[model samples]
Target: MNWLILVIAGLFEVGFTTCLKLSDNFTNFKWSAGFFICISLSFYLLNKAIQTIPLGTAYAVWTGIGAVGTVLMGIFFYKEPSDFLRLLFIFLLIGSIIGLKIVSE
Candidate 1:
């Protein structure tokens, strides 16, 4: 259950980050509101997850998910570069996150 919450929190991290980009330095009211709401929810869920999961492990995984999601969003939505090396490194990051999950047990 906690792990599920952690994953949800990580997803919210992605949501908040995307809103941050769309917020245009907090000038845009809707996106800025979304940013604040998502961030608050993300942190609240993260706090709940940490009640069961180790701090370091949970934090690392959360950030890893956010980082990967953000990069993918950048590529797909912003049309950022999708070069081979960048993709390879993203996969490597995924592998590392999985490794962390395995070892954390």
Candidate 2:
């Protein structure tokens, strides 16, 4: 259950990060609201998750998921860079995140 919450927290972290980018520096009212709400929820869930998972491991996983997910969102939805090298780097990030999870367990 704690692990499930951690995963949910990670997803929320991704959502908030994407929302932050979409917020246009907080000028976009709707996006800014969503960003803050999601961020609050993400942290709340993260606190719950960290009750069982070590702080360092949980934080690393959370940030890794958010970072990769946000970059993917930028690439696909915002039409950010689609270079092969950039994608390869994203894949490497994904691999590192997975390695972190595995070692954490």
Candidate 3:
């Protein structure tokens, strides 16, 4: 259902952020188009999700997914640091997202 849709939207948020990174300040045409497409789908699905889910809860989950995903993408794809504290916080964020899902239910 709607929770699934919300999760998909959150994943699209991930996709858009990755695309944004690859866009290279709009210098890359394909990535730029991907960014726009992903973001649009993300928002559209978010809106659909919010028809049942509370706005604050949905937004929080959405951004949480985006933040965690972007950080992971940075580490895996861009050679960004994955120091102890950074990883710990990422795990914490993931736990919080899960908590929100439980509480929302």
Candidate 4:
């Protein structure tokens, strides 16, 4: 359940960050609302997850998910760079996240 909460929190973290960019300095009413809601939900779930998961492991996975998700969103949705080296770094980050999870478990 803790892992599940972490995953959900990560997803919401991604959503909130993306929405934050979309909010355009909080001018868009809908985006602003979504951003706030997602941010709150993400943090709440993260707090719940940390109840059982070690702080270091939970934080690592949480940030990893958010980083990867944000980069993907930038590439696919925001027309950002997709250079090979950048993608490789993202994969490396994922590898590190997985390694940490395994070690934690």
TM-score of each: 0.97, 0.88, 0.96, 0.97
lDDT of 1 by residue, 1-105 (tens): 998999899999999999999999999999999999999999999999999899999999999999999999999999999999999999998998899888876
Once fitted onto the true fold, the runs of candidate 3 whose alpha carbons sit more than 4 angstroms away are none
> What is the per-residue lDDT of model 3 for residues 1-105, given as tens digits with 9 covering 90 to 100?
988998999999999999988999989999999999999999999999999999999999999998999899999999999999999999999999999999995
- Evaluation by TM-score, superior candidate among 1 and 2: 1
What's model 3's lDDT at 92?
98
- Worst-scoring 10-residue span by lDDT in model 4: 96-105
> Number of backbone collisions per candidate, in order?
0, 0, 0, 0
Q: Name model 1 segments beyond 4 Å from true.
A: none
Candidate with more favorable, higher lDDT: 1 or 4: 1
lDDT sort, best first: 1, 3, 4, 2
Q: Model 2 — which ten-residue stretch has the worst lDDT?
A: 96-105
lDDT of 4 by residue, 1-105 (tens): 899899899999899999999999999999999999999999999999999999989999999999999999999999999999999999999999889878886
Ranking by TM-score: 4, 1, 3, 2
Q: Which residue pairs overlap in candidate 4's backbone?
A: none
Higher-lDDT candidate of 1 and 2: 1
